[model samples]
Target: MGLNEAPLLFNFEVESSENFTFIPMSVRFNLDRFGLRITLAQWQMLPLEDRKLLARFPVDDDTEIEPNFDHALFEMLRTHANVEPEWFTPEEAPLWRRTDSVPEGVTHQAGLAGLTAPSVARWAELDPFKRYVLAKLSRKPEANHDFVPAMKEFGGGA
Candidate 1:
Protein backbone atom coordinates (compact mmCIF):
# COMPACT_ATOMS: atom_id res chain seq x y z
CA MET A 1 0.00 0.00 0.00
CA GLY A 2 1.05 3.56 -0.62
CA LEU A 3 1.68 6.05 2.20
CA ASN A 4 -1.92 7.26 2.27
CA GLU A 5 -3.19 3.75 1.79
CA ALA A 6 -1.00 2.30 4.50
CA PRO A 7 -2.04 2.60 8.13
CA LEU A 8 -0.22 5.52 9.77
CA LEU A 9 -0.66 4.19 13.30
CA PHE A 10 1.39 1.13 12.34
CA ASN A 11 4.57 3.10 12.91
CA PHE A 12 3.96 3.79 16.60
CA GLU A 13 6.61 2.70 19.06
CA VAL A 14 5.16 0.79 22.00
CA GLU A 15 8.47 0.62 23.77
CA SER A 16 11.70 2.50 23.58
CA SER A 17 13.35 2.16 27.00
CA GLU A 18 13.13 -1.10 28.89
CA ASN A 19 11.71 0.55 31.99
CA PHE A 20 9.01 2.70 30.42
CA THR A 21 5.58 1.12 30.33
CA PHE A 22 2.11 2.03 28.98
CA ILE A 23 -1.35 1.95 30.46
CA PRO A 24 -3.71 -0.48 28.79
CA MET A 25 -6.29 1.24 26.59
CA SER A 26 -9.30 -0.43 25.12
CA VAL A 27 -10.20 0.85 21.67
CA ARG A 28 -12.26 -0.52 18.85
CA PHE A 29 -10.20 -1.58 15.85
CA ASN A 30 -10.34 0.61 12.78
CA LEU A 31 -9.19 -0.93 9.55
CA ASP A 32 -8.82 2.50 8.04
CA ARG A 33 -6.22 3.44 10.67
CA PHE A 34 -5.18 -0.05 11.71
CA GLY A 35 -6.01 0.67 15.37
CA LEU A 36 -6.96 -1.69 18.19
CA ARG A 37 -8.06 -0.97 21.73
CA ILE A 38 -5.94 -1.79 24.77
CA THR A 39 -7.49 -1.77 28.21
CA LEU A 40 -6.43 0.85 30.79
CA ALA A 41 -5.75 -2.00 33.21
CA GLN A 42 -3.03 -3.37 30.97
CA TRP A 43 -1.53 0.09 30.70
CA GLN A 44 -1.30 0.38 34.49
CA MET A 45 0.90 -2.73 34.54
CA LEU A 46 3.61 -1.04 32.55
CA PRO A 47 6.63 0.45 34.29
CA LEU A 48 5.71 3.87 35.63
CA GLU A 49 8.46 5.58 33.69
CA ASP A 50 7.17 4.27 30.38
CA ARG A 51 3.66 5.30 31.26
CA LYS A 52 4.86 8.78 32.09
CA LEU A 53 6.66 9.12 28.78
CA LEU A 54 3.64 7.98 26.76
CA ALA A 55 1.58 10.56 28.59
CA ARG A 56 3.53 13.20 26.73
CA PHE A 57 2.54 11.73 23.39
CA PRO A 58 0.00 13.81 21.53
CA VAL A 59 -3.53 12.57 20.93
CA ASP A 60 -5.48 14.15 18.12
CA ASP A 61 -8.80 15.95 18.58
CA ASP A 62 -10.60 12.69 18.04
CA THR A 63 -8.62 11.16 20.88
CA GLU A 64 -6.58 9.42 18.22
CA ILE A 65 -2.83 9.07 18.03
CA GLU A 66 -0.82 8.46 14.91
CA PRO A 67 2.33 6.51 14.08
CA ASN A 68 1.27 3.57 16.19
CA PHE A 69 2.70 0.06 16.31
CA ASP A 70 3.10 -2.05 13.23
CA HIS A 71 1.16 -5.25 12.70
CA ALA A 72 3.69 -7.25 14.64
CA LEU A 73 3.42 -5.17 17.77
CA PHE A 74 -0.35 -5.11 17.42
CA GLU A 75 -0.37 -8.84 17.89
CA MET A 76 2.16 -8.64 20.71
CA LEU A 77 0.20 -6.01 22.61
CA ARG A 78 -2.95 -8.04 22.24
CA THR A 79 -1.33 -11.28 23.34
CA HIS A 80 0.72 -10.00 26.25
CA ALA A 81 -1.78 -7.45 27.45
CA ASN A 82 -4.58 -9.97 27.11
CA VAL A 83 -6.56 -7.51 25.04
CA GLU A 84 -8.97 -9.14 22.66
CA PRO A 85 -8.35 -8.38 19.03
CA GLU A 86 -11.05 -7.32 16.60
CA TRP A 87 -9.94 -6.86 13.03
CA PHE A 88 -11.40 -4.49 10.43
CA THR A 89 -10.34 -3.09 7.11
CA PRO A 90 -11.75 0.28 6.22
CA GLU A 91 -13.56 0.65 2.96
CA GLU A 92 -12.08 3.13 0.55
CA ALA A 93 -13.11 6.71 1.25
CA PRO A 94 -11.75 10.10 0.32
CA LEU A 95 -9.12 10.92 2.93
CA TRP A 96 -9.35 14.66 2.42
CA ARG A 97 -13.08 15.03 2.99
CA ARG A 98 -13.56 17.11 6.12
CA THR A 99 -16.54 16.35 8.33
CA ASP A 100 -15.75 18.29 11.53
CA SER A 101 -14.83 21.77 10.31
CA VAL A 102 -18.23 23.42 10.40
CA PRO A 103 -17.16 27.00 9.92
CA GLU A 104 -15.81 29.23 12.78
CA GLY A 105 -18.97 29.74 14.85
CA VAL A 106 -20.86 27.02 16.74
CA THR A 107 -22.77 26.80 20.00
CA HIS A 108 -22.17 24.13 22.61
CA GLN A 109 -24.14 25.75 25.44
CA ALA A 110 -26.38 22.70 25.76
CA GLY A 111 -23.47 20.32 26.08
CA LEU A 112 -21.48 22.61 28.35
CA ALA A 113 -24.41 23.51 30.58
CA GLY A 114 -24.97 19.84 31.39
CA LEU A 115 -21.31 19.18 32.26
CA THR A 116 -19.98 19.27 35.84
CA ALA A 117 -17.12 21.51 36.95
CA PRO A 118 -14.70 18.58 37.12
CA SER A 119 -15.85 17.36 33.73
CA VAL A 120 -15.37 20.80 32.28
CA ALA A 121 -11.98 20.99 33.98
CA ARG A 122 -11.01 17.63 32.52
CA TRP A 123 -12.18 18.80 29.10
CA ALA A 124 -9.79 21.72 29.34
CA GLU A 125 -6.98 19.24 29.90
CA LEU A 126 -7.40 17.98 26.33
CA ASP A 127 -5.11 19.07 23.52
CA PRO A 128 -6.05 21.43 20.71
CA PHE A 129 -7.24 18.74 18.35
CA LYS A 130 -9.78 17.55 20.90
CA ARG A 131 -10.82 21.12 21.38
CA TYR A 132 -11.24 21.51 17.65
CA VAL A 133 -13.48 18.47 17.46
CA LEU A 134 -15.61 19.71 20.32
CA ALA A 135 -16.02 23.01 18.56
CA LYS A 136 -16.95 21.27 15.34
CA LEU A 137 -19.37 18.85 16.97
CA SER A 138 -21.27 21.53 18.86
CA ARG A 139 -21.56 23.96 15.98
CA LYS A 140 -25.04 24.77 14.70
CA PRO A 141 -26.35 26.10 11.38
CA GLU A 142 -26.83 29.56 12.88
CA ALA A 143 -24.77 29.67 16.01
CA ASN A 144 -24.83 32.92 17.97
CA HIS A 145 -21.58 32.58 19.83
CA ASP A 146 -18.29 31.83 18.24
CA PHE A 147 -16.99 28.34 18.83
CA VAL A 148 -16.47 29.59 22.41
CA PRO A 149 -18.99 27.24 23.97
CA ALA A 150 -17.33 24.17 22.47
CA MET A 151 -13.98 25.57 23.47
CA LYS A 152 -15.20 25.85 27.05
CA GLU A 153 -16.59 22.34 26.84
CA PHE A 154 -13.07 21.19 26.08
CA GLY A 155 -11.69 23.50 28.78
CA GLY A 156 -10.86 26.49 26.57
CA GLY A 157 -12.55 29.72 27.57
CA ALA A 158 -11.69 33.27 26.68
Candidate 2:
Protein backbone atom coordinates (compact mmCIF):
# COMPACT_ATOMS: atom_id res chain seq x y z
CA MET A 1 0.00 0.00 0.00
CA GLY A 2 1.27 3.45 -0.85
CA LEU A 3 1.42 5.70 2.21
CA ASN A 4 2.19 9.36 2.81
CA GLU A 5 5.94 9.52 2.44
CA ALA A 6 7.96 10.51 5.55
CA PRO A 7 11.36 11.98 6.16
CA LEU A 8 14.34 9.62 6.29
CA LEU A 9 15.04 10.58 9.90
CA PHE A 10 13.50 12.61 12.67
CA ASN A 11 15.22 14.91 15.17
CA PHE A 12 13.85 12.98 18.16
CA GLU A 13 15.72 9.80 17.40
CA VAL A 14 19.20 9.21 18.81
CA GLU A 15 20.77 8.32 15.49
CA SER A 16 24.03 8.83 13.74
CA SER A 17 25.03 8.25 10.15
CA GLU A 18 27.95 6.30 11.63
CA ASN A 19 26.28 3.54 13.71
CA PHE A 20 22.57 4.04 13.24
CA THR A 21 21.80 1.98 16.34
CA PHE A 22 18.09 2.52 16.06
CA ILE A 23 16.01 2.07 12.95
CA PRO A 24 14.66 5.44 11.85
CA MET A 25 10.91 6.05 11.84
CA SER A 26 10.85 6.37 8.06
CA VAL A 27 12.24 2.84 7.64
CA ARG A 28 9.76 1.49 10.18
CA PHE A 29 6.90 3.29 8.45
CA ASN A 30 7.90 1.92 5.07
CA LEU A 31 8.41 -1.56 6.52
CA ASP A 32 4.91 -1.54 7.96
CA ARG A 33 3.51 0.04 4.81
CA PHE A 34 5.08 -2.78 2.80
CA GLY A 35 4.36 -5.48 5.46
CA LEU A 36 7.96 -6.57 5.94
CA ARG A 37 9.75 -6.67 9.30
CA ILE A 38 13.37 -6.89 10.36
CA THR A 39 14.75 -6.88 13.89
CA LEU A 40 17.25 -4.39 15.29
CA ALA A 41 20.02 -6.99 15.21
CA GLN A 42 19.29 -7.83 11.63
CA TRP A 43 19.42 -4.15 10.84
CA GLN A 44 22.79 -3.87 12.56
CA MET A 45 24.15 -6.67 10.40
CA LEU A 46 23.50 -4.60 7.30
CA PRO A 47 26.19 -2.36 5.91
CA LEU A 48 25.85 1.36 6.58
CA GLU A 49 25.18 2.06 2.91
CA ASP A 50 22.46 -0.59 2.78
CA ARG A 51 20.81 0.81 5.91
CA LYS A 52 20.92 4.25 4.33
CA LEU A 53 19.17 2.85 1.28
CA LEU A 54 16.37 1.46 3.43
CA ALA A 55 15.96 4.86 5.06
CA ARG A 56 15.85 6.74 1.75
CA PHE A 57 14.12 4.37 -0.69
CA PRO A 58 10.77 5.60 -2.06
CA VAL A 59 8.88 2.31 -1.78
CA ASP A 60 6.00 3.99 -3.57
CA ASP A 61 4.90 5.08 -7.05
CA ASP A 62 8.12 6.82 -7.89
CA THR A 63 8.83 5.20 -11.24
CA GLU A 64 12.50 6.07 -11.09
CA ILE A 65 13.11 4.34 -7.75
CA GLU A 66 12.34 0.72 -6.94
CA PRO A 67 8.57 0.56 -6.53
CA ASN A 68 8.60 -2.47 -4.22
CA PHE A 69 10.47 -1.89 -0.96
CA ASP A 70 9.69 -5.30 0.53
CA HIS A 71 11.24 -7.24 -2.32
CA ALA A 72 14.33 -5.10 -2.68
CA LEU A 73 14.85 -4.78 1.08
CA PHE A 74 14.50 -8.52 1.64
CA GLU A 75 16.97 -9.14 -1.14
CA MET A 76 19.50 -6.93 0.59
CA LEU A 77 18.70 -8.40 3.98
CA ARG A 78 19.06 -11.94 2.70
CA THR A 79 22.17 -11.35 0.61
CA HIS A 80 24.12 -8.78 2.55
CA ALA A 81 22.88 -9.31 6.08
CA ASN A 82 21.79 -12.97 5.77
CA VAL A 83 18.60 -12.09 7.57
CA GLU A 84 15.14 -13.42 6.83
CA PRO A 85 12.33 -10.94 6.63
CA GLU A 86 9.46 -11.29 9.04
CA TRP A 87 5.98 -10.31 7.99
CA PHE A 88 3.47 -8.58 10.23
CA THR A 89 -0.17 -9.44 9.75
CA PRO A 90 -1.94 -6.54 8.10
CA GLU A 91 -4.51 -4.64 10.15
CA GLU A 92 -7.82 -3.51 8.71
CA ALA A 93 -6.60 -0.03 9.40
CA PRO A 94 -3.16 0.62 10.83
CA LEU A 95 -3.12 3.20 13.63
CA TRP A 96 -0.86 5.61 11.83
CA ARG A 97 -2.85 5.49 8.62
CA ARG A 98 -6.07 6.54 10.30
CA THR A 99 -6.63 10.26 10.67
CA ASP A 100 -10.11 9.99 12.14
CA SER A 101 -9.12 8.73 15.58
CA VAL A 102 -6.37 8.98 18.15
CA PRO A 103 -4.84 5.70 19.35
CA GLU A 104 -5.31 4.67 23.00
CA GLY A 105 -1.75 3.53 23.51
CA VAL A 106 -0.52 6.92 22.45
CA THR A 107 -2.90 8.59 24.87
CA HIS A 108 -1.76 6.32 27.66
CA GLN A 109 1.89 7.09 27.14
CA ALA A 110 1.26 10.79 26.86
CA GLY A 111 -0.61 10.70 30.13
CA LEU A 112 2.21 8.85 31.82
CA ALA A 113 4.66 11.30 30.38
CA GLY A 114 2.61 14.13 31.92
CA LEU A 115 1.85 15.50 28.52
CA THR A 116 -1.55 16.07 27.00
CA ALA A 117 -2.47 13.67 24.25
CA PRO A 118 -2.83 15.05 20.80
CA SER A 119 -6.46 15.75 19.98
CA VAL A 120 -8.30 13.89 17.24
CA ALA A 121 -8.19 17.04 15.16
CA ARG A 122 -4.53 17.55 15.98
CA TRP A 123 -3.75 13.91 15.35
CA ALA A 124 -5.43 14.07 12.00
CA GLU A 125 -3.29 17.05 11.13
CA LEU A 126 -0.05 15.13 11.54
CA ASP A 127 1.55 13.09 8.78
CA PRO A 128 1.40 9.30 9.03
CA PHE A 129 5.06 9.07 9.94
CA LYS A 130 4.59 11.23 13.03
CA ARG A 131 1.56 9.16 13.94
CA TYR A 132 3.64 6.05 13.47
CA VAL A 133 6.26 7.37 15.86
CA LEU A 134 3.67 8.22 18.48
CA ALA A 135 1.80 4.91 18.18
CA LYS A 136 4.96 2.84 18.24
CA LEU A 137 6.60 4.72 21.08
CA SER A 138 3.50 4.65 23.23
CA ARG A 139 3.08 0.89 23.07
CA LYS A 140 6.64 0.09 24.00
CA PRO A 141 7.54 0.88 27.60
CA GLU A 142 11.22 1.05 26.83
CA ALA A 143 10.49 3.42 23.99
CA ASN A 144 8.25 5.76 25.95
CA HIS A 145 11.18 8.06 26.41
CA ASP A 146 10.74 9.23 22.88
CA PHE A 147 7.05 10.03 23.18
CA VAL A 148 7.30 13.54 24.56
CA PRO A 149 10.29 14.36 22.43
CA ALA A 150 8.40 13.28 19.33
CA MET A 151 5.31 15.23 20.37
CA LYS A 152 7.44 18.30 20.96
CA GLU A 153 9.10 17.89 17.62
CA PHE A 154 5.80 17.34 15.80
CA GLY A 155 4.74 20.61 17.43
CA GLY A 156 1.05 21.16 17.92
CA GLY A 157 1.92 23.25 20.97
CA ALA A 158 3.22 19.99 22.49
Best by lDDT: 2
What residue pairs are clashing in model 2? none
lDDT of each: 0.37, 0.73
User: What tens digits encode model 1's per-residue C-alpha lDDT throughout 12-93?
Assistant: 2233222333231111122223534445566555445434434343333222344443343355555556555455544344
Candidate 2 — which residues are off by over 4 angstroms?
1-7, 14-18, 59-66, 141-143
Displacement of residue 125 (Cα, Å) in model 1 is: 19
Q: Model 2: how large is the Cα RMSD against the reference?
A: 4.0
TM-score against truth, every candidate: 0.34, 0.81
Across 1-158, the per-residue lDDT of candidate 2 in tens digits comes to: 34335436777775432357778776876677766788888888888777776777653423335556677688888898777888877565767668888898888888787788899999999876678778878776543666777889999435
Specify the poorest-scoring 10-residue window by lDDT in model 1. Answer: 2-11
Which ranges of candidate 1 are over 4 A from the true structure?
Answer: 1-33, 58-128, 131-150, 153-158
What C-alpha RMSD separates each model from the true structure?
Answer: 11.5, 4.0
In model 2, the Cα lDDT at residue 13 comes to 73
